[model samples]
Target chain A: MKSILIAMLVAMTLPFGLATPACAGSGDVVVENAWSRASIGTSRPGAAYMDIRNAGDEDVTLTGLRTDLAGMPEFHLTSTNNQGVSSMSPVGEIAIAPGETVALAPGGMHAMLMQLRRPMEEGGTFPLTLLFSDGGEVTVEVPIRGIAARGPDD
Target chain B: MRRRSVLGYGAAAFGVIGMTLFAGWWRVDGPGAPQAVGARPLPLTEMEFSLTNHEDRTVGPETLIGSPTIAFFGFTYCPDVCPTTLADISDWLDALEGDAEKLNVVFITVDPERDTVEAMAEYVDYFHPAIRGWTGTERQIARAVEGFRATYEKVPTESGGYTMNHTASVFLFDAQGRFVSTIDYHEPREFAVPKIRRAMNDEEAEGA
Candidate 1:
């Protein structure tokens, strides 16, 4: 009876669009609007952007990420200097404060997916896993859009 | 009833917060500080430098000056900015309807070592058929870059590789080959398309 009540409570908090319970059982962090640009060729790397919102009271840190579509999926921060010279560097981890939202977008923060297994086609989807510092993981389905698309809404 | 009210309130809060965050993100990602078109034409009517086009043909200021030119400087290896800019320009030209043919779109390589004439030809074709890709000897490329006041340097990476750090602006020239304006690197179609139209209009008016 206790476990049944707990399960009911868990179901109440799990946000919408989270395809499965296996990916996000914590119900603390909500992922939405996950999308990436369609790849031009298989050799070139692709970028994915999304909004990660923390609904829980405690701070959450995204330590790493994984995806089957690419050989490596790593977090990166692109910095452009005053001279319009742009460079991208690896970022250790991203921390989201309670009730705060972190946006990974083009020309800013992005999840660089390198060595794509195949060309990312428009309207196709892939599975992604967000590993948190606390050992929890949230899986999401990212939709592929056109190269110029700014976000899922676009 | 109480649960519904709480959920509604939470959604409202999210709507307000999400909008604020989106606005902030757009400001940072969009073109930050683009140079506007100057009222007076630059003294150098034509930028002079000997370079080879994708067709292995010699090209200089005289060849590029017959039409209003749209030019950018970058390398083929550039993952984000270069491809994004080229794709944006292609979209802008497509939006121009038939007027796209009236302009000359050029891509000059900052890394001459890797971007050969044949490589340039292949790269520009991925974007548009009319887009011309240019590259030459290091000294020749330096002269062209200097003429435009653009800067490029080689940055060594930890993996025993290197990447070219270059100016990310698109330059516009009049039909007479005089410098007219510059669009910020990676400006969206909504922002860059109108500026291109304005340049074409000026070029037509000058011809009249």
Candidate 2:
């Protein structure tokens, strides 16, 4: 009976310990609907939007983002004035709670891909890496979409 | 002794006259009244076409030619740059005080897929009620953009999504539907306001 109780305790604690590393590892950051607009040969800028989900036990903050396709990647928010004029402002940090999701979408918050290195071809894939506040980073593949294509919700 | 006193008084008067002339010249030709740079002269490149306004009414290039029009190309879905630029134009108009009547601001939607006549009407009205919004079929919009040599493209994304990328320059046209000058996106206020005033003044001078 003593042996059986010890074996059961080990099994329970082993699973918890194994799960912790997996949760702490890279797969915890899930990006859905990541995409960028197509650009002409000019130095036109583009934007990318996606939903970021954190399925971990602790909170995480997105601190940095990068894409080789552009000169710089900036997180931004858009606000309208009383005259109904809209403007874009930089975002310093984006916090996500455990088991929650944060969305970067049009007409609100978005990621600006400034100074395109090359034309963003349609149906092509671009690489992006998002750095977290906890020193964790996740790299994802974003596919280019047409100019008039609507978002999933749109 | 009397001669010396008269000469001293004359010397003082000469000094005062010299100082007044110097001050007058400084006020007229100094940095304070420096010649304006980027002042676009009138009678820019002109083109004529008929298109539908936000009200779905037919508006021809003639409508743009009779007034000093501040034209911008953007889409309704543009959450930032479009609105910001439009707002800046509105602020400039307000700053003009009573001179707003001399200006006609027009927003041309580059995203024709979503910015319909009704949509443009609502979107442009949200800015300044006096501002005009213009949109037409994709072909018409393409023709208009091509005439201005503006560039735009649609890119595909994951999950069947896309975004419109286009040139960000603001085009200014005189009352003759002529292309006056192009303002860069990051133009400073000190430069922009003076350029606009010069354009308006040029129009008045031409009319006179």
Candidate 3:
């Protein structure tokens, strides 16, 4: 019986030791509905939005992001005064609590992509890497929708 | 007792500042100068101004007044707001059925520096063929915005280029060139469609 218990413990610990970084597919931190709009005549600058959810028991901080789609990928926020004047600014870091969802939406929080290598053509797809402060890196495929799409669901 | 007096003065000062900020906010939101909805007609001043259209022809209130006009002030470079609003307008017009013909939709560019007539033409064409676009010199654009009582300012970015900070509301005008109502930016289609129908119907009533 003592040997059997030891074997069971070894089996439980083996999965953890061999586990890989949560790649947004393992569901530790999941990114859903990642989407950006199509470019018009010029590629210029573009914006993307998505929902980042933390399903694990521990909190996670989004420390970095990368994409070949743009020269610069920045987390940004759009703020409007009561007078309807709108402004955009870069956000330093975004933290997601355990079991909570953070939405990056238009007219609010978004990912600003600058100096695109090519136009984000409609119906195209691109890859994004989201790095967590806990050293977990997730690669997600983002879809390119219409120029006036409100979101991926649209 | 001295500490209590200081606290009292601080509270009073804070209240004064709060009220001033609230007033400013109200002014910007209530562009037509706050009036009870559906109770009284807006005392709209004459909607008169001249700007070059996409075709490089001069147009003004005289040309747009014959039909109900839906005008939005935005730039072509706007990634989200402008295109989203234009799409919403297109959908609203579609929901209008045949009544869409009685309405003329216009987009006036606030960033006159980059939004030339040629650019405006291409931009509007991508949205809807019926939607005309307008752009002009800085002075002309400024005068047009002033006439509409709208506001816009240029904000410089780190890259040395600039973005426009402007009113996001869509202004509705009756066929007689009277101010009807302002549609809040990104208002749901159900809410906006009705307001537009009412604006168009009101024109028919006046004409009859």
Residue-by-residue lDDT tens digits, candidate 1, B92-157: 888987889999998999989988997788778767676899999999898788777777888874
| TM-score for all models, in order of appearance | 0.72, 0.50, 0.79
At residue B28, give the lDDT of candidate 3: 56
lDDT of 1: 0.77
True contacts kept of each: 0.27, 0.05, 0.40
Cα deviation in Å at residue B50, candidate 2? Answer: 2.3
Candidate 3 lDDT at B1 equals 100
- Candidate 2 vs candidate 3: the lDDT winner is 3
- lDDT tens per residue, model 3, B1-208: 9999999999999999998878887775656356332232232335456788998999876777778878878998877678778888887887887888789888999998899898888778767566899988888788777666677889887766677888777888888878888787888899999889878888899999
In candidate 3 the C-alpha lDDT for residue B156 amounts to 86
Report the error of model 3 at residue B137, Å. 0.8
DockQ of 2: 0.06
By DockQ thresholds, what CAPRI class is model 1? incorrect
lDDT at B197 for candidate 1? 78
- Measure candidate 1: CA RMSD: 16.4
lDDT of 3 by residue, A87-109 (tens): 67778878898778888877777
lDDT of 2 by residue, A1-154 (tens): 4533653454345435543453363246567767665544434467777878775557788987898988777787755433223345668888888778788766567777766788777688789888877677777787776543335322
Cα RMSD to native, each candidate? Answer: 16.4, 15.2, 9.1
> Tens-digit lDDT track for model 1 on A2-93?
53365345444565654244434234776767888777667666888887877666778899899989887888776666666667777898
